[model samples]
Target chain A: MLNVEKIRADFDVLNPESPAKAPVYLDSACMSLKPRQVVEAMNDYYANYPACAGRSSHKLGDKVTKKVKKARELVTEFINAKSDDEIIFTRNTTEGINLLANSLGLQKGDIVLISDKEHNSNLVPWLRLRDKIGIVVRICPTNEDGTFNLDNFSQLVSGAKLVSVVHTSNLDGVTNPAKEIIKIAHQAGALVALDAAQSIPHKKVDVRDLDVDFLAFSGHKMLGPTGTGVFYGKLELLEKLSPFLVGGDTVESTSYDSYKMLPAPEKFEAGLQDYAGIIGLGEAVKYLSQFDFKYIAEHEFKLNAYITNELQKIPKIKIIGPEDPKLRSGIVNFYIDGTDMHKFAVMLDEMAGIEIRSGRHCVHSWFENKKIYNSARVSLYLYNMMEDAETFITNLKKILEIL
Target chain B: MPCIVALIVFGIMGIFSASHRALAEEAFGCVFKRITFRPCNTGFAEKIKGKILSKLLVRSAFLAKMVNRHYEILSWIFFILMVGSTIWVGRGVYNFYVYGSCNGLNESGFCAFDPSGENNKVTSVGDDSSCGITQQSEQNVTLENINLSGFPAINTGSKDTVVFVGCYACDYSRRAYPDIKKLVENKKSNYIFAHYPAKGDTMFLGEAGYCVQKEYPEKFWEFNDYLFTADKDYVLNKSNLDEILSKFGFDVKKISDCANSAETKTAVQDQTTELKKTNLYGTPTIFINGKAFVGPKPYRVYRSAINKFIFF
Candidate 1:
C-alpha cells in the first residue's frame, strides 16, 4: 500500500499546510507535478558541473559525461532494455515518434498500422509519411467503449510493414494488449513501435518481455523535467534504422566530403543535449523504481474508482471509456452534453484550486469522429488521496449545480 | 454584450496591471469581432462569466445558478448601465470644464472630480451659523426685477453689463473681486458693484462705499478694490476706514458725515432691499448679461457668460 500523505510531502506544490494555497492536481496525464527530488537533481547539475557531455576532456566534462551515461543506463534498466546503447534521449514523445517517422525507411505503398484513436504525436507523423512517401496508413477500429479490439487489429496487420500504435490511450486510458499485438505483428513480418507516453508511468513496460522493436515515452508526464524523453530499440534494429537528425556530436570523424557517424544512440542524438533534464529524468526513474508498480497501479485504481463511481451518479455525464474503472486506470474522462469543457476546467481551477485537463486531450481525430467537441479529464497519480478526490467531487457538484 | 463592458472596465484596469492588459487585449479582439457582425468566438465572455460564477458558487449555489441562468440578460443590463454611466461621466466632465462645477454652475453635490464640491461653495446670505438664521435653499436664487441703477457703476456706456453683488468682509467675495475687476477693465463692459453685507460687522463698509462713490466717483473703484484686498482685521477698524478715505483724496470728515447721515443710512437700507429682490442666496453673486452666477466662479466661467466676448 502507498502512503500518499508521505508521498505528497516530496512535492512542494502539494503541501497543504503551507501558507500558499495548494492545488488539488488531477491532470497527471497531461503533465505530472515534479517532486522536489527531481527538481533538486536538475538544480544540482546546473549548479555544479554545468558542462557539455561526450565532447570535452576536462574534469567538468567527464563528470557530465558520466552522469549522462548513468542516466542512459537507468532508463535502460527501467524499461528492461538489453543495452544502454539502445536508449536515445530526445525532447519528448512527439520528437521520439518524429525521429522514427523520418528514419524508419518505409517506402511507397508500405503500410503503417495505427489505432483509430491515437494521439497526434503518433497519428500525424504517420499521416505526414503517407503524404510524403506514399505509405499506406490504416486505422484499426476500437470497440464501442474505446477498448482495443484484438481481432480487428489482426485483420489489419497483414501486408503491413510496421504496426505503430498507442500502448495506452491518453484520451481513454485503456492499456492495449501490447504483448499480444507484438506477437501477432511479428508473425506477419511487421515491426512494432509502441507509443508508451501514457503507459510507463502507471504500470511496468518491459521491452524484452513484449519484444517491441521500438518504444517512446516522455519524462514530463512521469514526474521528470520537461523536454526529456526516451526512445528505446533493439541493437540490431536501431543499427538498421537510418539517422533522422545528424550533426556535430553524432559523428566520430569528419572530412570535407565525408564523415563517419557514431553508432545507434549517438548517431540519433544530434547536437548538444538537455543534460540537466536527462539527469533529472534519471532521478525520476530512480525515485519511481523504489515503489512497486503494483502499488502504484492499485493507488491509481482506487482513486479512479472513487471518481468514476461518483461521476456515474451525476445526471448528464458521459464517461468516454469503458464502464469499469480498472480498465481506464487512473483516468476518468467525461463531459456533459452542453457544457463547455474549457470553462468547466477553468471553473474547477477557480472554485477549489483543482486542476484538470480539458479540451480534446490532443486526440482531435477521436473527438471529431464521434462529433463530441471536448471532455474534462481527471487523471490520478500515486500522490493523490481520497480527500483530494472528495474535494474534486464536491467542487464538481457545486459547479454542475451552478453551471 | 459582456465583452463591451469588459473592454471598458479592463481597459482602464489594464493601465496598471499586465495580466489585465492581456484580458483587455482579448476583450478588444472580442469587441472588434462583435462590431463587425461576427460572433465573439474567443470565449473571453464565457471565461469571465465562469470566474464570476465560481466565486458565487462558494457562497450560494442557488444564487450562482440563478445568475448563470440569467447571465446573458444580466450582461445586457450591465452593458446598458455601463454605457449610460459613461455618457453621464462624460457630460459631468464637460460641465466641470464650462461651469466650474461638475453638476452645473452653483449646484453643490458630490462630484468625484471635486469630491468636496469646493467649486460651488459660497458665504451664505442670511445663514451664518452664528447669526441664528435658517439657511435658505440655493435653488431660490434668481435675478428677477432687480434695479441695478442704484449700485456703484463703472463703464456704464458699454452694452455687456456685469453686476457683482458682494461684501468687503466676506472671503469668497474678496477672492472673486480681482478677477471681475480685470475682466471688466479688459472686456470694457459696464460693471456694477453692489454691496450686500453677507456677514456681520460689514454694514459700515456698505455705508462708506455709498458715500465714497457719491463724493469721490473717480477713486471709488480703486478705493473699493483696496477695501476688498486689505486685511480683514485692519479693514474692520473704523479708524482704518477714515485713513483709507483720506488716502483716496476724499475729505475724511466730509465722507464720515455723509456715511453717517440719516439719508445715506436710508439709501443703504433701500439698496439692501433692492439686493434682496434679486433673490441672491450667497455672497459674490455675479450677473453677466443678466445670467446669474452665484459663487466665486473661475475666470473662464465669468468670461464664458459674456455674450459679446469670445470665449476660450
Candidate 2:
C-alpha cells in the first residue's frame, strides 16, 4: 500500500504553519497542492538558471532550453506519445481545446459529436465552431448514473467528422470508455480528441495503447504548477495538423515575403515558453510516478465507499451519479434537500475545515439537463485517508442533524 | 458785391437754422432732420441756396453711418474666426497628446515634457526623416518617435480597444493568451495582443508569436500581427541591429539597439519613475487613451470601458 502520511508530508501546503491554515483539501479535482520537490524545482529555475530558452548560446539559456526539452520528454513518456515531437506544451486544457478548434479544419456540413457530460471548455469551443463553420454538433446523452450511453454514442459517431469525449467526468467522477469511443470514431473515419484532464492524474494513461488521435490535460490538477499543460497527438496526425501560433522559434527560415515553418511540436510552440512551470510539472510527474496506482486507487476507493455508505444514512441527501463503487472514481457529488449548496459548502468549511466544491462546476449544461441547480462535491485523492473521510462523515451527520 | 455778401450770409444762416432744428427734433421726438426748417426769408435765390446746403449735409451724414456699420461687421467676423481657430487648435493638440501625431512627419508629433530638462520639448516622435531623428545610442538626447506604451485607438461601433502586450514565455502571459484570443474572436471593438518578450525570453516566444497570426488570421489581422515571435532571435541577436525584425514586420534590431542605447534607456527609466509617481500599478494594466486601469480585469471591465468611450 502507498504511504499516505509520507505523501502528505511532501506537500508543504498541508502543514498548519501555512498562511491558509492547512485546509482539509478535498478539492483535488479543481487543483492539487504542490509537493515540496515540485516547488523547489520551480524555485531553482528562477533562482539559479533563469534565462530565455532556445535563443541565446549563453549557459543559462542553454540550460533552460535543456530543462524544457527534458520536461517535454517526460511528458511524452508519461502519456506514451509516439515521440517527443508529438507533445506540445500549452497553458491549460482550455487552450488545447481552442487550438484544436481553430486548426482541425471543420467545414460546413461537418458533424462533430460530443458527450452531454462535457465541461464548458470542451463544449463551448465546438459550439463556437458550429456557429462559425456551420458544422453540426451532436450531443450524445449519458445514462442516469452518469455512464456514457455507448449505443447512442455509436450511432452518433457514424458519419461524424470528429468525435470529442471527456475521459472522466469532473462533475461526478464517472469514467467513460474512451478506448471504445476512439475505436468507433476511427471506424467512422473521424478524428478523436480526448479530454483527459481528470484521467491522467487519477490513473495511468498510455496514449499509444489507447490509440486516440489527441489528448489534453492540465499540470495543476496532477500536482504540477499552474499555467502548464500538455497536448499529445499521434505523430503522423500531429505532423498533419497546423500550429495555432507562429513566431520566432517555430520557423526554420523567413524573408519579407514568406517563411518556412518547423515541423510538429516546434511549430506548435510559437513563443517563449513557461520553463519554470514545465520544470515543476516534470517533478510532479516524477513524484507521482513513485506511487503504486493500484494502491492509490484502492485506498481512495475504500474511503469513498465508506463515505457514500455513511452519507446514505442521512435524510434528505440524494447522491448524484453512479451509486456503485466500481462505477465511480474518487468523487462523491450530492445535494441535501432544502439546503442551498453554497450554504452547505460554507457550513462544512466553517464547522470542520473540510473543503469542497459546490455549484455546477463549469458543467452547467449537465446540471441544467438534470434539472438540478447545483450540488456539493467532495473529491478525494491519494493524500486523503479513511480517518479524513470519517471526520467528514461525522461532521456531515452533525450538519444534517442541525438542519 | 452786396448780392454776393448777402448770399454767403444767407447760406451760413440756413446751415445754422437746419442744425438747430435737427437738435431740437432729437431732444423732443428722437427724430433728426424731420422738424420743418424755416423757409428762405429772401426769395427764389435764397431757396436754391438752402436746398443745396441741405443735400450736402445729408449725404455726408449717410456716408459716416455706413463706415461705422462696416467696421462693426468686420470686427464680428474676426471674433468668430478667432474662437473657431482656438477650438480647432485645442482639439488637434489633445489628439496629438493622446494618440501620438496625426499630421504627416515633422509638422505634427507628440508634445512630451522632458523630465531631465526645465523646458518641455515638442519632439517629433513619428516618421519624420528630416527631423534628424535617426537611431541614436541610448545616451543620445534624441528620442525614438513612437509611444510604445499606448494602445491602438480603434472605433468599432461600441467596443473599446484593449491591447495585451506579452512575451510567450511569461507564465502569466500564457495563462492570459487564451483569454486574449477569445476577446479577439468575440470581435469586441478594440482588442489586440501586443507580444513583447521580456529580456532573454527566447524559445516559444518566436514560434508561438507567429502561430497566433498563422492559425487565427482574422484575429491576427485584428491585432495587426506585428510583434516579436520565436524566430526573432536572429534579428534580436544580429550585430548590425537592423536586420532582425518580427514577422509582424517590426525592425527588432532597430528597436533593440534604440532601447539599449543610453538615451532611450534613460527615457524609459524616467518614464517608469513618472508612471510610479502617477500610481500606475502592474501589467496587464490597460489604458483608455492614457487613463490607466489596472488589469487582468474581466471581459466586463473591458466592455464597460469600451462603452463609456464609445457613448461619451
Candidate 3:
C-alpha cells in the first residue's frame, strides 16, 4: 500500500492548517493542489530558462525547447499514446474540445453524438457548432442514476460522424466504458473524442488500449499548473485536421498572400505556449507516476465508499449518480430531500469549513433533462484519507441535525 | 398558472377600484370581488405555500401543520404590506417630482444618502470576501540597482530591461513567477534576477544556487530550478540542503563552507541592503528600464509602462 500519510505530507498546502487550521478541501475535482515538486519545477523554468521555446536559437531557447519536448514525451508516456507527435498543448479541456469542434471540419449535415452527462466543455462546442453551421447534435440518454446506457449510445452513434463523450462525469465520476464506446463508435463509422478531464488524473488511461481517436484533459486537474492541458489525437487524424488558431510558430514558410503551415502539433499550437505550465505538467505526470494507479484507484475507491456508506444512512440525502460507490470512483454527488442544495453547501462550508461544490456542475442540459436543479458534490483524490471523509460525514450529520 | 393570472387581474382591479371607489360598475365590483374572492378561493399564493410547506411534513409534523395554516395568511400580509409600501413609494415619487425630494423630506441628500439597493445586493461590500482582491503592499519610492548572480538576464544590451528582485521560497514570489516569466517571454527587455532573502530558508536557497553557480556554470540554472520550481516550500537546514546540492554533483563540503563563509553571508546582507535601498515592500519589485514599475500587475501593465519608457 502507498503510505497515504506520507503522500499527504508531500502537499504542504493540504496541511490541516498552517498557522491555526483550515478547511478540509474536498474540491480537487475543480482543480488539484500541487505538490512541492510540481511548483518547484515551474519555478525552475522561470528562474533558469525564462526564455521562449522554439522561436530562438539561443542557449535559453534551446533549454526551453528541450524542456517542452521532454514534457511532450512525458505526457505521451503518461497516456501511453502511440506517438509524442500526437500530443498538442492546450489551455484546458475546454480549449482542447474547442480545438476539435472548430478543426474537425464537420459540415452542416453531419451528426455529433455525446452523452447527456457530459460537462459543459464537451457539450457546448457541439451545441455551438449545431447553431453556427446547422450540424445535428444528439445526446445519448443515460440510465436513471446517470450511468451511460450502451444501448442508447449504440442507437445514437449510428448517424453521428463523430461521437464526443466524457470519459468520466465531473458531476458524479461515473466512468463511461470508453473502450466499448470507442469500438461501437468505430463500427458505426464515427470518430471518438473522449473528454478525459475527470478520468486522466485519478486513474490509468492507456489511450492506445482504448483506441480513442482523440482525448482531452486539463493539466491543472492532474496536480499541474493551471492554463496547461493536453489534446491527444491520432497522428494521421491530426495531420489531416485543419488548424484552429493561426500565426506565430505555426508556419514553416510564408508568401505575401499564402503561408505553408507547420505539421501536426506545432500548427495547432499557434502562438507562444505555456512553456512553464507544460514543463510543470511533465513534473506533475512524474509526481503522479510515482504511485501505482491501482493504489490510486484503490485509495480513491475506499475513501468514496466510506463517504457513500455514511451518506446512505442519511435517508433524506439522495445520491445523484450510481448507487454503488465503486461506480462513482472518487466523486459522490447528492442533493438533500427538500432543502436548497446551494444553502446546504453554504451552511456546510460556513459552519464546519467543509469545502464541497454545489451547482448543476456546468451540465445544465443533463440537469434540465433529469429535472434536477442542483446538487452538492464531494470529490476525493489520492491525497484524501479516511479521516477527511469521516470529518465530512460528521460535520454533515451536525448540519442535518441543525436543519 | 391561471390562478396567478387571475390574482394579478384582481389585484389590478382592486387597486383601480380602491383609487376610484366612486365607480359603480367595474371599479366597485373589482374591490369587493377581489378581497372577497381571494380569501375564499385561497389563490395561487396559498397554492404555492401549500406546495412549499408540504416539504416540511417529513422533518417536523407540528412545524409543517403550523406553516400550512399560517402560510396563506402570511402571504396575504406580505401582499398588503407590499401594496402599502408601493402607495407610499408612489406618493413619495409624486412629492419628489413636484418638489424634487423624496419621502416628504425637502433636503437634496435625503434620498441620495438613503442607502443604495446595491448595498443590500447579496454580493454587496460584505460579500466581497468570496472573490476579494488580496490587499496589495505597494511603494512609490525610486529603487536602486539590485545585484543578482544566479542566472544571467536575456538582454543586458540597453538599460531597457526588467530586474525582478525576489526570493524563491516565498508564497507571494511564487505568484509573481508566472507573470514575470510571461513578461520575459513577451518583451525584448533584459530580465535580471536579484536575490532578496526574506526568510532563513530563502537564504539557504540563495546560497545553494550561488555555490552551485560558482562551481559549475552550466548546472547553476538546474540548481536554481531545484530551489524554486521543485516545491511549494523547501526546508533547508543542513542535511536536506546538502542532500539537494550534492544531488547536483556539487561538493557538499565546499557549498556548506561557502554558505557559512563571510562572503556568502555578507552577500545576503548586501542584497538586503540593496532591497532596502529600493524601498521594496514586496517580492518582485520590477524595474522596466531604470523606472521601478510599481504594483504586481499583469503583463499589459508592464507593456504600457515599458513602451512609455522606450518610446519617450
Candidate 4:
C-alpha cells in the first residue's frame, strides 16, 4: 500500500520533458533515480556550506565534518553496526572489495571461498589475489534458481581463511543465505565478507544479525548519486588490517626515513572523498526511511509478480531465476525467443516509449553458467505501480506480436 | 743461547724469503710487461697496429653513428625486449608462486585504432547538410540544377518546363563551380533546384536546359537525381572525383568562365537578397517563379509541390 504516484511525483526526472521519462522505470536494480529531497540536500551543501571535511579549522570545514560524521552514524545505524567508526566511505563496492583483498595479508596455501553467483566486482578481486599472493579460491555451487546451497557452501568453507559471498544476486534477485553462511564460517574460524550491493536497498540489513566480518554496498543503487558507497567491518578486525592506499590523511606522524599510520577508519581513507555524493547518500537514506521497509518490499513484490505473471502468458518468453513471488525480490529476467535483447530494448524505446535493461546485467558468469548470452531485466521499485507493470506487459506482448 | 740464535736465524731467513719473493714478483711483472708491450717484438700489436687501429676506429665510428641515428629506436627495442624478458620472468614467478600463466598475456595485445588505416565511412545522415541527395524524374523530362547557391548558374529557355527539388537545407549551393557546370550540362530538359540560405522560409527554384518541367508529377524524381549526383562528393575526394563522375556518366567542364560573369553576379545578388528576406540560412533550396520551398520532403511530396508551378 505504498503511494506510488506520490512517490513518482517527488522525482523531478519523471516529468514529460525529461529524456529519461520512461513509461515504467524497471531498471532500479541497475540504478534508481534520485528523489528531489536527496538532490536538494546535496545542492544545499554545495550552495551554502561547501567545504572540505576534516581538513581546515574554519566554520565551513567544521560544518562539513559534522555532516560527514552524521552521515557515517546514519549508515551505521541503517546497517545496525555496533559503532560508527567501523564505517568507511568508498567509491563503490568494487573499491571496497579491492581494499580488503589488497590490505589482508593472504599468504601461500591460504584459501578464499566464494559463490558462483558473485558479481564480477566480487569475483575478480579474489581471482587477482590468488594470482598476487598465491591464495587458493574455491567457488561454492549455486542452485538452478541462483540461490545459495548451504550444504555446498559448508563443504567449501572448511579450512578456508575467508568466505566471501553476495548477500543477494543482482542477476536473479535471489537472496542468499548469508546469515547461515556467516554462522558456519565463524564456527570454522574464517572471516566472512558480504556483498550487499543488491540487498541494502530492497530490505533492512542488520550486519549484527548477519554477523558478517565485512559488508559492502553502493549509494547509486539505493537512490543516491554515483561515486559513493560504504564499507563496514567489525572494529576489532578493522584495527588489525593495514590500509592498502596510504597518503596524507592516513598518516599520524611522518619523517624522511619512516612514517606512523593513523588508526582504523582514517587510515583506510586516503585522498579526497566524494563529499557531495556522500551528502546525497545520507539524504537518500533519510528519504528512504520515510517509507516502511515492509510496505516497500510488498509493493515491489506485487508489481514484480504482476509483470512475471503477464510476461509468462506470452509464448517463447522464458523468465530466468525464481518463479515463486516469495523468493524473488523485484527483478524479472527474461528473453523473447529469436529476438536480440539489445534490439528488442531499442525497439521498445523507439516504438512504444518503454525502457528496459537488456544484457548479462554484469553477472556474466551466471549467464554463462545458464548458457544465456543476454537477458532483459524488468526491475521494479517502491515508486512503481500495478498500472506501470500492466503497461510494460502490454507493450511486451505487442513487441512479441511484431517480432 | 741456542733458542735466541735459532729465533734470529729464523727471522733472518723469513726476511730473506720475503725479499726474494718480492724481487721475483717484480721481475715477473717486468718480464710480463716486456713481453706484452715490447716495441721490438713482432707480436700482434707490433705486426698489425696500424691496420688494427684503422679498423678499430672505423668500427667504433660506425657503432657510434648507428647509436646516434637510432637512439629512440634502440631505446624502444630495448624496452620491448626488457618487457618481454620481465614477462617471461613474471611467468616463471607466477608458476612458482601462484600456478601457471593461465590468463597471462593470452592475447597478443590490447585493441587500438590503426593510425595508418582510413576510418570507416560514417553512413548515417548526420546534419541536414549531410543527407547529400535525393533524385526525382518526371514525364520524359530531367531538370538538373545545383542543390545549393554559390554554385554556377544554368541558362534556361522561357518555354522549358523545369521542376525544382529541395535538398536538405539548401546545402547544394555550397558545391564548387565544376559540380554546378556538370549539373547544368547533364540537364536534358530544364533545370530546377532549390535555394535555402536562411531559417524559416520556403524554397526558391530556378530554370535551365530544354523543357523547364518546374511543376509536375515527375519533378521529385528528376530533382532527386540531381541531388544524388551532388551527394557523390560527400565521400569522394579529388583523387576519386573522375571515378565518381564517370559512375553518373556526367561529362561537363568546370565553369571557370562564370567566375566574373554578369549572370553569376546577378544570381548571387538575388540569392543574397532572398536569403536575407526569408531568413532561410541553409541549403538545397528551390526557387521557381520567384517562390521558394525549404527543408527536405519525400520524393512524392517534391513532385506534387513542384507541379504547382510547372506543367510537363
How accurate locally is residue A50 in candidate 4, as Cα lDDT from 0 to 100?
Answer: 91
- lDDT digits (tens) for residues A59-100 of candidate 3: 999999999999999999999988888999999999999999
lDDT of 1 at B67: 95
The candidate, 2 or 3, that scores higher on DockQ is 3
Off by over 4 Å in 2: A18-21, B1-312
Q: What Cα-based lDDT does every candidate model obtain? A: 0.89, 0.66, 0.74, 0.64
TM-scores, each model vs. reference: 0.85, 0.56, 0.58, 0.57
**Candidate 3, superposed: residue stretches over 4 Å from native:** A16-18, B1-312
User: Model 2's CAPRI class?
Assistant: incorrect
Query: Considering every candidate listed, which one attains the maximal lDDT?
Result: 1
- Please give, for residues A174-226, the per-residue lDDT of candidate 1 as tens digits: 99999999999999999999999999998999999999999999999999999
Candidate that would win on TM-score: 1
Candidate 1 ranges beyond 4 A from true positions: A18-22, A102-113, A124-140, A150-164, A180-192, A233-264, A267-271, A342-351, A398-403, B2-51, B127-163, B178-193, B201-222, B246-274, B288-290, B297-312
lDDT per residue, candidate 2, A198-280, as tens digits?
88888988898888998999999999999999888888877878777889789999999999999988888888889899999
Q: Which ten residues in a row have the lowest lDDT in candidate 1 chain B?
A: B127-136
| Number of residue pairs clashing in candidate 4, backbone atoms closer than 3 angstroms, sequence gap of 3 or more or interchain | 61
Q: What is the lDDT of residue A95 in candidate 4?
A: 91
Q: How close is candidate 4 to the true structure, as a TM-score?
A: 0.57
Q: How close is candidate 3 to the true structure, as a TM-score?
A: 0.58
